[model samples]
Target: MKTIYLVLPCYNEELVIQDSAIKIEDFLRELVDKKIISAESRACFVNDGSNDSTWDLLEHLCETNAFLCAISLAGNRGHQNAMLAGMMMVKDRCDAVITLDADLQHDISVIPEFITQYKKGYEVVYGVRKSRKGEGAFKKVSGDAFYFLMNILGTKIIKNHADYRLMSSKAINALEKYGERNLFLRGIIPSMGFSYTTIEYDEKPRLAGESKYSLRKMIQLAATGITSFSVRPLHFIFFCGMFFFLISIVMLIYALVVFFHNGSIPGWTSTVAPIWLLGGIQLLALGVVGEYIGKIYMEAKHRPRYEIDKVIWK
Candidate 1:
């Protein structure tokens, strides 16, 4: 049996952290009973400087559950870095590390599958969502558009896959060598060159707490992901410049045609300039729109929205 450490990153999850830890403890016991994971396997929760009682709850959980551990970051490092911190803490102690959120929106049932894939010599296993059936329409569209745009910008990412993934200790070691100041794991993990597979699960409703990732944060993450993985945005800007240059050349040709053929003609520039300008502007705008439409068309049939981050549990 393999020793697997599940690294759950938390921020302000004080309200439900205790209950969530209990749930993970139950799952850990099941794995231990089946002898699928070693008794040394643990659930490691990294507390990212929460102001509430999160760290205290985690401490109590560690005392009560043999397979539970906690790390308290000196300050909030947000979700990605907090996960990284947990992985770093547990890397030497375990054979594999599985990173997920504290709210348990990432279905725990598929965790056994993660261990199965790890046992098969796969270095990484991604937990992918089958659908976004219970989300709001705005979140659905925006999430769709974000990944669509990211792909268009040339970031190779598994659609509908969030941070929920398992990495072998060696893979985790390889991941730590990346030295970029602004790192996006979604972009970095694929480039790690690890053998990987995906297990699909129906994304569950958040068990507690409001989502920390707002719409603004979503855009920020998308931009970071794109910039980290690909320079297609620069390619896009260069193409736009070339497009304007072509329009300018066409206009200049029109001017030269009027000057050489009909020098005596009046109002040629005035007549053609507005028409060319408006037509060029409209075409450029439509071209930009079409690029996005092409992006959407590329992924419209693929994966569902990736994260919900919030759910008002009754």
Candidate 2:
């Protein structure tokens, strides 16, 4: 039997930590009882510097539960960074690691399937949602748009898959080599070209408290994923510029012909309209280029992804 470690990244989840911890501990015990995993398997909760009493609750849980451990970041480092911190910390300690949300929205029941796949020689197992039946209207639309954009932009990723998945020690070690400042795990893992598989599972509703991913954060995540994985957006701007340049050449020819035939230029509206349109296009192009530049700048700085403030284990 392999030792499995569950890495859950949490931020401001005080409302659901205690209950979620109990449920997760029970599930781990059940898996052990069934001989699905080793008795030494552990659940590692990562505190992404939550302002609430989430870390305190984790300390209390760790004191009482042998299977539960905790990692606290120096400060809130976002979901991706916090998850990376926990997984990197425990990769050497476990045979495989499974990452999921602290809110229990990721179905814990399918975890056995992940281990089964790992045992069957799949190094990376992605937990893909079977359907978005329960998502809000805005969430559904935005999610659809993000995936659509990713597809159109030539980013190879498993649609409808979040950060919930299992990674064997080998796969996790391979992941540690990637030093992307703008981290997008969903896109990066597929690009690894490892022997991977997907498990379809139904996503459950949040156990408690509202979701931390607000609209701003969602957009930020999408942008990071896009800029990190695909250069097609930058190429798109170049193509648009070439297209407008061709149009301008044709318009200039028409204007010269009209000026020679009637001794006057084209209408003011025609000239002004294109000026305004091209101006806006120029600004949009600059903004897109700036985003890429910003990524390069951040990467050049070579900052640490996260810092661990404390860790607890028995």
Candidate 3:
């Protein structure tokens, strides 16, 4: 039986942490009893510097339940970094690791299929949402747009997959070699070219507190995913520049014809329109380039992704 570790990244999830822990413990116990997973398996929660009683509660839970443990970050390092920290911490001890959200939005029942896929020699197993039927209009549209944009930019990501995935020790070790600070795991993992498979699961609603990922955070994540994986945006700017140059050449010819025929120059509207258009394009291109430069700046600092303030294993 393979030893599995459930790495759940938690922010301000005090409302649902206890309930999630109980459910996880029961599910894991069932798996252990069935000999599907080793008894040494554990459900590890990474507390992402939540400003609540989350850490204290986690300590209590770990003390009472052998299946539960937690790692407390010194500060909020965001979800991706917290998940990375948890996986890295437990990689050596577990045969495979499955990542889940503390909000319980991802279907935990599909976890057994993840293990079954892993047993079939797949190092990476992605849990993809079958549909976004239950999501709000804005969320559904944005999620679809994000995946579509990623595909158009050739980012090599699973269409409907998020962070819910199972990675073997081998896959996790390969992932550790990627030292990027601006991590978009959804894209990065697929680009690693591992033996992988996908399992479709029905997405569920949140069980407790509001989603920690607000509109701003979602936009930031989308931008990170796009910029980190593809330079196609920069290439797009280049093509736009070429197209505009050709248009300018044609306009110059038209102006010369008008000048020769009517003995007059173009109107202010024509001049101002081109000026504003080019200025906007220039600023946008600069912003995209600046994002890449900022990523490079952060990565060059070689700072730790997260600092462990406390660890509760027993």
Per-candidate Cα lDDT values, in order, are 0.80, 0.93, 0.92
lDDT of 1 by residue, 123-222 (tens): 9999999998977999889889878987777667888899999999999999878755455898899887889999999888888778777778777677
Q: Which pairs, if any, clash in model 1?
A: none
lDDT of 3 by residue, 1-314 (tens): 99999999999888999988988999999999999999999999999999998888898888988899999999999999999999999999999999999878899998999999999999999999999887789998888888889989988888878799999999999999999888889889999999999999998888888888889988989999999988999999999989999998998999899999989876846688779989999999999999989999999999988899999986
Tell me model 2's lDDT, rounded to 2 decimals. 0.93
Superposed model 2: Cα runs more than 4 Å off: none
Q: Name the best candidate (by TM-score).
A: 2
- The 10-residue segment of model 1 with minimum total lDDT is 305-314
**Which scores greater on TM-score, model 1 or model 2?**
2
Best by lDDT: 2
Candidate 3 minimal-lDDT segment of 10 residues: 265-274
How do the predictions measure up, each by TM-score? 0.80, 0.97, 0.96
The digit string of per-residue lDDT tens for model 2 on 167-280 reads 999988999999997888888889998898999999999988899988898888999998998899889998998998899799889988998999988576667777888899
lDDT (0-100) at residue 23 of candidate 1? 94
Stretches of candidate 1 exceeding 4 Å from the true structure: 253-314
Task: Give candidate 3's total backbone clashes.
Answer: 0
